[model samples]
Target: MNKEKWAIVTLSQDGVALAQRVAQQLDDKMCHIYTKEKYAKQNMQVFDTDITSFFRSIMDQYDIICGIMATGIVVRAIAPNLGHKSSDPGILVIDTKGDYVISLLSGHLGGANDAARLLAKRMDAQAVITTGTDVKGSMAVDVLAEKLNCVIADFTAAKDVTALILNNEAVALVNQENCELDGVVLPNNLELLETSRDLEEGKYAGVILTSMSRQKPEFAIPSVQLVPQKLVLGIGCRRDTPGEKIIAAVAATLAELQLNEKCIKAFATIALKQNEPGIEEACKQFKAKKVIIPDAMVQMVQSRFDGSDFVFKTTGLYAVSEPCGYIASSFGKCLLEKRKMNGITLSVWLPEK
Candidate 1:
């Protein structure tokens, strides 16, 4: 995951210093500071004393707030303002002494839980996580797959496997070493068989079992396998398109292709023009990385195009456009395009493993 921006507010000089150290440790940008009595009036990286002004400035500048070195006063001052925004960044409180890190808001959804754990490790403090999912060590498969950018081929089998892990039961599998079993169960009895076929054919009544390879045994036993999906989709869309439309198009295309959303790793587009707010929103909504291409490349791609009235030329392979002619000519393959909407296009390109 890309590092998120943080605003650190501290009353003491020591707090400021600690905040700086934490920022450096996390490799995140620290935009402003709030101190006692005196507000340093400066631009870009400014410092302020007035609690309201400092908080207002923070509200405008950073995505997440890492409250360090300040206790009840800082949190209480900012608590009211935090309520107005739904997408407010994760709010974390760290002691000046650096003994503990607590995620005060947006703990699970906004990635505060993960951030707190990371900050704790860096600060050598305890990560105070109260989320049930983390406590149980059984993260949702869909959520995990979304965060990791991996696929869950068989949803039914995946559910059963995840359930076993959550219950902490031992599951038998071949090549267990390669799998990430952080929250999985392993069987105590490891009767080595000649082949995976033997295990697959034999029924183990207890927990889920799986194999790394695809050769199924002659006899059938219930097991789950984690497989990598090898499809990369390139997309093009009209300027100023909303994320919902693009998402709808992508989802529809994937459904048509009989593919799951987890198969997608990342998305790329020309960086020349302003990014469609919808596309940016969609990337965040889908937890997919959106890459914008350079302007010079967009111009080059435009030069090669011949057939469309809707001309959006960008250096990136994916050009957001409304015209089917332009979308078809622009991309090597027409995975999907806007039929009812004025502008939207998608192209599926498989990445080389």
Candidate 2:
């Protein structure tokens, strides 16, 4: 996964120094420093009138936001911007003296807890993590989904299932792929079931972790569908193609193959299409990375793929989608070789493990 951008919001001059210290320790490129116009330093951002507006403008751009101010003030400022655990940025708060690092919001999915731990070590401060899963030393399903590069199909259902795990209630993983857990420990009340029997009978509140779409009876179990990023679509669309059509075509292709849309890792394409609107739109909507494969790299792998005369004539490449997908996947196995629909051509690849 690409490293997410970071931002530091400091209310006082002392806080500004602390922010600069943090920027020096972590990635300077991804980090931003924000302050009120009155307290702004020479190289810092000065909020104009609305601090909330300034914060919101960078909310989606950054992965983690560290605020050096009073906890109550930071909370009120970010409360309105609170969103799903997966989509929201990690929120951290510390005093102007930088005495304590508090993991305030999106502790797991947005990495606030992890960021706190790191920054605490850097500053030799106490890291305050209060999540039930973390405090009790148990698995958090949302963290697991993120670590495994999966998507939660139903966020509301996930809330119910995670609540059970946190409460030490019976929960299970209806794992269809049987992928290795990599030593991931389950809570005392949770277990892994081989099939969906208990799920169908409403005997257990669990999670269904699979890339293939399954048709199951609506049962009493408060289960969530967790699908992994197992496939990447190498796509090339004609200029002016509507984003809806591009996204719909990808969806139709996945549906035809019985694959879950959530399993898509990214939209891989030639570097030439880096600014392609339809491709960019689809990727953003799906929460998939937009990977660009340079022409030289594409040329090296294009020979492995069969040439399409019409595609070469139109896109100036023998096989744009398949080669891009193959190269972007680090030469992973190709599942669906270049297939065309409307003005889009696409190929799917299983990402290298």
Candidate 3:
């Protein structure tokens, strides 16, 4: 994950000192301090523009906006730009005295709550979190996705399910494979069921874990499907293959197999092809990280895949895609078998659930 960009904004002279202190802790590079021209000091930028416009300008530029002012003032200025929690930046407010740190918006998905806690500790102030999930001691689906490094399917649905849990409504975790969560292998839900069938359809809320790309009708309940980063793609292409072809092949394969691109955490290819433009471009396009498998490891899994004799003689391995995919997945088996496209070969792997 990339480092979050933060902005420390001050409206009053008293708040300027506290803002600078927070900015100093956040570092000058990732965090910038902004203040009204009247209150601006050395090392901080002056807001020559309207205060509301200033917040509007940084809505998309910064990931977290910390305001040293009244919560109402900040809210009114930022209200117009506010959209969904999934897309908005974290909004936090602190008073001029720096006594309480308030998480004003996007408390979970955008990490305002987490940011407030850290900032409160640094400022020695109270962290005022009002999100229902925290108050009710309910499991937050978005936070779960963050911890597991997975993409959530149906963001709005996830929010609804979270609401149900926060309201003290019963929800069941259908532990199909005993999928371990952060090494807590034990079941934690009050109503644990072996399968989704155990739930009485729409009458109950449920959560299911899977690597498959979701279809809306898969679950009957107001539930969140967490697509675990279990699928990995191993790709190989002849030298000079255009990046477009490589990316298209991978995209089409995933679409056909109903696999979410977010679930594909890594892209792997033989070390020789690590610098290949096609492999590099495809991974970049999908925002997935890359893994270069050594020739020795590729050779180990080579016998498991069927390969073209010409590819074998040229690359020293019978196949690059299949072997590298397995190796990148920590030797996990392929969920989708090896496939050929033009000069490229692609295969998909999923860790054992």
Q: lDDT of each model, Cα atoms only?
A: 0.55, 0.81, 0.78
TM-score of each: 0.52, 0.88, 0.76
Displacement of residue 267 (Cα, Å) in model 2 is: 1.7
Q: Runs in model 3 with CA error above 4 Å?
A: 1-5, 11-13, 24-30, 36-63, 76-83, 182-190, 200-213, 216-220, 237-248, 269-287, 292-320
lDDT tens per residue, model 1, 17-99:
77667766866544455555443233324454466556755664566677775557657767766752235567788888888
Tens-place lDDT per residue, model 2, 252-343, is 88888877887888889987788989998999877798989888888787888888898778767888899888888878988888888998
Winner on lDDT (1 vs 3): 3
Against the true structure, whose TM-score is highest? 2
Which numbered prediction scores highest in lDDT against the true structure? 2
Q: Which stretches of candidate 2 lie over 4 Å from their true place?
A: 1-3, 27-29, 197-208, 214-220, 296-306, 330-334
Error of 2 at 194 (Å): 4.2
lDDT of 3 by residue, 264-311 (tens): 778888877878887788887876788988888777768877867998
Instruction: Please report how far candidate 1 places residue 287 from its true position, in Å.
Output: 4.3
**Which candidate would rank higher by lDDT, 2 or 3?**
2
Give Cα distance to truth, residue 179, candidate 2, Å: 3.5
lDDT of 2: 0.81
In TM-score terms, candidate 3 sits at: 0.76
- For candidate 3, the 10 contiguous residues with the lowest summed lDDT are 182-191
Candidate 1, poorest ten consecutive residues by summed lDDT: 319-328
